[model samples]
Target: MTVTIESVITCPSCSHQAAEIMPTDACAYFYECTSCHLLLKPLAGDCCVFCSYGSAKCPPSQEQKGCCA
Candidate 1:
């Protein structure tokens, strides 16, 4: 099955708006916010930045198997 997720995330430190593409096969550990040039990584124990703060979960995590595993 094909999985997808979309969300608007703001950097916690810089409040930068970041539009991210959640990968179906892997978790994104780091995201660079274009607006504020902030480098974001998943919070401890989270799979991706989306999971840490975005309104939506990453595509891999949305699957029944869970994120990147």
Candidate 2:
């Protein structure tokens, strides 16, 4: 499978959305909403904020072995 690196994160607080570049080396634990300033964290059981709220999974999560492996 081709690993997707782009993710669209929509802030749950204000419904704002932004396309962000996902890091390939590490998990992004927190993301600040550019529109509302809401700090976003990964949902329960998720590895990173991108995995929780993004349109695509984080790079680490996309690995064949799973996140943070």
Which pairs of residues collide in model 1? none
State residue 1's C-alpha deviation in candidate 1, in Å: 11
Worst 10 residues of 1 by lDDT: 16-25
Model 1 segments beyond 4 Å from truth?
Answer: 1-4
* Per-residue lDDT of model 1, residues 1-69, tens digit only: 665567788888777676766666777778887877778899888888888978778876777677866
Error of 2 at 12 (Å): 0.4
What is the total number of backbone clashes in candidate 1? Answer: 0
Clashes of each: 0, 0
lDDT, candidate 1, equals 0.77
Candidate 2, superposed: residue stretches over 4 Å from native = none
TM-score of 2: 0.91
Model 2 pairs in collision: none
Identify the leading candidate in terms of lDDT: 2
Instruction: Please give the RMSD to the true structure for each candidate, in Å.
Output: 2.2, 1.1
lDDT (tens digit, per residue) of candidate 2 on 1-69: 788999999999999999999988888999999999999998999989989999999876787557765
lDDT value, residue 61 of candidate 1: 71
